[model samples]
Target: MEMRSLDRSTLGPENGFSQLLKPWPALNSPFKGAWCVVAPGTSTTRHAHPDYEIFIAMTGEATLSSEGEEITFRQGDIVHFPPHTDHQVINDGAEEFQMYAVWWDQETAGRFLERHDGQDGDRDGQEG
Candidate 1:
């Protein structure tokens, strides 16, 4: 049983957001977890993992786009993404968006979503 507090000082910005990854090199955990901080007007790329992903809002609000559907969620709300489904989250609010995220089957999930967004950018739930 390993236990530790979230150290915000260790969080780093990446892909338009600041995140605290919990899976350390020697942790040997089957899942990957993170505390994500999405800056206002920023959005995460439309991406998918081979395993299930979960997100719990910790602060602010954002619009989540899964497949072609969109919904707004705020602090305290929980969101779940089915395996291998594409999704994107955008923070349109004036304040920074924050969430606690967890991905099951870290190995498979990492292999599947290794690539970041391409030229298309964040999926806008639009059909071309």
Candidate 2:
């Protein structure tokens, strides 16, 4: 088994986050993991990708904006985002908001989309 640690010191200023695990052929990982810490009054870029993702809140509270909807989540809350869904996290609280993010490979996401087609309405997986 491969073991990795969460090292905040490695977090880059450009992303305010650090990648923990990723699809490495040698490691045989099919998913990616990241540890993110959003400073107060800051927010992550509103973006989307062709990969299924889930975010687990570790501390503080934040507002998750996705698909034109805003949802509030606190510590221990988990949120899932389907592939191609635009999302952004805003740390409106005084303390920093920490979250662990995991996303599956694009191939896996494609298969999931095919299986769930039209179940949640048409999702062309394209940005508007």
Candidate 3:
């Protein structure tokens, strides 16, 4: 079994947040997993990709913007993002916002979308 840590020292800045666990051939994982942290008053870039993604809020609170709507979430909340939808997250709280994210490959997302009748299961997106 492979083991990894989410320690701050292991993360690097990407876009506008600190993240780690990016997918690579050496990882041998089917999907990408990341530990992300957004500082107060910061936000991630609004972006989209052809992969399905989900985020688990681990600390603080933030507002997620997607498909013309803003949703607020806090620790213990989970959010899903459909492929190709533009989305961004803003940390308005005083503390840092931390979350765990996972996303599947495009081929896997395509198959899942097909099974779901092409209706986007969720209306948010994220950058790898």
lDDT (Cα, tens digit) per residue for candidate 2, span 3-116: 677777777653445456554444434467788888899888888988889999999999999999999978999999988999989888899898999889678656556545
Q: Name the lDDT value of residue 43 in candidate 3.
A: 93
lDDT of 1 by residue, 14-101 (tens): 5335465755543544567888877788898788768788999998999988989999979999988989998888998899888988
Q: Model 3: clashing residue pairs?
A: none
Tell me the lDDT of model 2 at 20: 63
lDDT of 1 at 125: 48
Of the pair 1 and 2, which is ahead by TM-score?
2
TM-score of 1: 0.69
CA RMSD of all predictions: 14.0, 10.6, 10.6
Model 1 C-alpha lDDT versus the unseen true structure: 0.74
lDDT per residue, candidate 3, 63-90, as tens digits? 9999999999799999999889888889
Report lDDT per candidate: 0.74, 0.78, 0.78
